[model samples]
Target: MRILLTGAGGQLGRTLIDRLPTEWDIHPFTSGELNITHYPSVKHRFLNLRPDVVINAAAYTAVDKAESEPEHAIAVNAEGPALLAEAANQTGARLIHVSTDYVFDGNKSTPWVEGDTPSPINVYGLSKFAGEVRLINTLPDALIVRSSWVFSEYGQNFVRTMLDIGLQRRQLSVIEDQIGNPTYAGDLADFLIFLAQKPQVKGVLHFAGNETISWFGFAQAIFQAATAICPAYASMQLTPISSEQWPSPAKRPRNSVLCSLRLAELGFPSSDWRARLSEVVPQLLAANVLKKAN
Candidate 1:
């Protein structure tokens, strides 16, 4: 089957390129290759490729900046998927659009279920939610996977950021209020491949990492894991701070955690995020983000 992939440059998109089966035909489109926000470009590309499926990994993920640039966020995140869906509908292709936990308000005491009603608290969340709304209207069968805290060897993410600051500064402070699952890009790719093959698995799904923790708590794990990987991390000092203490334009989810019971039942078993982190940290470090001999 022919597969058309957008946002071929993100952390998840990079991993998806590697994990997708070599047998299938893949036509990758970068930002320069395809501007999804523009309908003419998206329609032209889709008509040219006439792919069997379109996996849209492209998104404007600037959370803090979204508060100020809500229009750009909506155009890229919300409107982009709608345009992709239009192409997919015309080409009679399946659509796999990636979404985020930011769609939720993060007030739930428990992890969010697939059926939970979304109430995004910030511009980013609202934009993503708008995308979802348009997708369902455009194509009822489109697969939408709602994930959280996605990190990988490539791209700018929390894991790489923490590793950088953890090594560069003796003292680093992280927000203690936020909580969510940390999913590896490769892990997410594996599950996506399964859904791609099994077209029946359409609609909203969650593929969050196996474990759940607060931002500060997750930092402690990162440093602890770093120490395990590179013993030198024992010398690092990491501090915890409240979100109010470090003000940002956007209001992040205090309880961004999501429940994956539905995902497990659907055959996508959970992965040990800590164990996965240990495995990938080396690559991230070697990728030069850490920049020290491990």
Candidate 2:
């Protein structure tokens, strides 16, 4: 299959570039190379390439910053996917777009299912939800995967941030009230590739790590994993605090755990997040060590 991937410079995009099936021919584009916000550029590129599948991994992910720059966020997150769907429709290509769990209000006690109505509380979430609506309206067959708390070896994410901060500061504060599943970008990339080959999968789907934890709990796990590789992280202190204690420009959902019932039914099993973290933390610490030496 010929697959065209957007956001190749991002965490998920980077992972997908490395993990995509070797048999498939990939035309990867970073935002700098092909800005999704510019429909003429995206459409022209797609028409020429004529890919069998188009995976949109690009997004405006600054949750708090979106409050101040809603227009920019909408242009990238909402308008971009819609334009991609239009191009894919003209080219008769399947589209797999990545969304977020933030679409929900985060008030539910149980994990969110695909059928749940979205009630986004923040500009970032609202923009993502809008993107989903736009894509579905343009192409009903488009596959939309909604995930949460993504982290990996590449890109700016919570895991890397905590590791860097924990090494530099002896003490830190993390919000304990917010809870959600943390996804491994590598695993998500693998699944997206699996879906690309399977034409049967359509509509909204949920995929996330097996376990759900708060930011504070995730920090503890990160430190535990890092300390084994680098002793300096062992002395770091992580203080658990409430969301109100650390106010942000945008309001976040208190609970945004996604239930991957549909994903499990499709035969893709969920992996333990802590186990995945252990595998990644060591690599991250090793990279840090090498960076300091140079």
Candidate 3:
């Protein structure tokens, strides 16, 4: 299979590259190499590569920073996907785009399903929702998988942030009101690769981790996992606080948990994030130790 993957430097992209079949022909490009917002460049690459599948992992994911830089966020998260969808349509290639759970306003008490209408409360969420809309309009058959709270050993994420701060600070306050699934990039990558081969699966699908918890709860879990791997994290104290207590530039959904009912029907259930977390914490600690040694 010929695959063209964008956002090669990102956590999900890196995981995808690592997990994808070694026998397949893969063309990976970082944002610096191929700017998806630029139509001519995207078209040129699509024409040259003519990949059977195009996995678009590129996105502007800075939720808080997006309030001040809506244009930049829209260009990458919204326009980029549209351009990629157009190119994929022209080349007759299947486009599998990764999206976020933030697309929902978190107003629903129940899990947000694919059929639910998105009413993004923040600029980042709005941009991602716009991307989903444009991609659908451009290529009706394109698959848009929406996940949440993604983290991995490679990139800057909530897990890494907590671990880094835990090592330095004795106490940390986290938001308790907001609830969502914490997806592992490796698991999301595996699902994406599986979907790439299943051409029949198209449109918006929610593929997040099976477990759902608030930021504060997630922080506790992170610390728990870290303490087992690194004894230094045992001293860290985590306090649960409301969203209003933790001031941020962007407003997040209080209930952005996604429902993966469709995914379950497909026979591939949602990933166990706690299991992945156990594996990831050790890798992160080992890397940190190695970094210090250097």
Candidate 4:
């Protein structure tokens, strides 16, 4: 199968490239190589490659910064997908897009399901939801996989941030009110590949970590895993605080946990983030050690 992948520099995109079957012909493009929002560029690339499947991992992911830069966010998150969907429809290519769980307003106590209508509260969420709507409207058969709190050793994420801060600081403050699943990008990448092979599965699907946790709780788990690899992290102290205590430009949903029952029914269950955490922390610390040695 010939696959066209966007956001090759990102955590999920990098993971997907590493994990995808080597036998298949893959064309990976970073934002610099192929700007999805540019109409002529997208059209030219799609017509040239004629890929069987197009996986879109490109997105404007700065949740807080999006408040001040709504235009930029919309351009990348909303317009980019629409352009990609248009190209995919024109070229008869299947599009698999990655989205966030922040689309909901966090009012619902239960986990957010595929059928639930999205009422985004912030600029970032609004942009992402718009992207989803545009993609579906342009290409009705496209697959949209929504995940949450993604982290991996490769990217700038909670796990790496916590490890970096824990190395220097003795005490750390984390938001405890917000709750959601922490998805490992590597696992999400694997699942995306699994979905890619199955063309019949089109529409919105939620795939996240099996465990529901707050940022504070996630930090605790990160440190717990980190302490085994780097003993310095054992001395770090974490304090949980409400969202209001740490003021930000953008308002976030208190509960954005996704329901993966539908995905589980499809034979691919949600991954255990704790296991992934255990694996990634060591890789991060080992890389740090190597960096120091170099």
Candidate 4: tens digits of C-alpha lDDT, residues 51-169: 99999999999999999999999999999999999999999999999999999999999999999999999999999999999999999999999999999889899998998787678
Q: After superposing candidate 2 on the true structure, give the runs of residues whose Cα lies further than 4 Å from its correct spot.
A: none
For model 2, how does the per-residue alpha-carbon lDDT over 54-126 read when each residue is reduced to its tens digit?
A: 9999999999999999999999999999999999999999999999999999999898999999999999999
TM-score attained by model 4: 0.98
- How well does model 2 score by local distance difference test? 0.92
Error of 4 at 218 (Å): 0.6
Question: Against the hidden true structure, what lDDT does model 1 obtain?
Answer: 0.87
Question: Residue 67, candidate 2: how far off, in angstroms?
Answer: 0.5
What is the lDDT of every predicted structure here? 0.87, 0.92, 0.92, 0.94
Q: Worst 10-residue stretch by lDDT in candidate 3?
A: 260-269
Q: For candidate 3, lDDT tens digit of each residue in 115-185?
A: 99999999999999999999999999999999999989999998888888886799998999999999999
Which parts of model 4 are misplaced by more than 4 Å? none
Q: How would you encode candidate 1's per-residue C-alpha lDDT over 1-294 as one tens digit per residue?
A: 889999998888899999899999998888898999999999999898899888899999999999998999999999999999988999999999999999999888988988999999999999999999999999999999888998888899888898888667777888887889988888888887788888887889888888888888878888887887778777877678898998889888888887765675677777568888887778766676435443
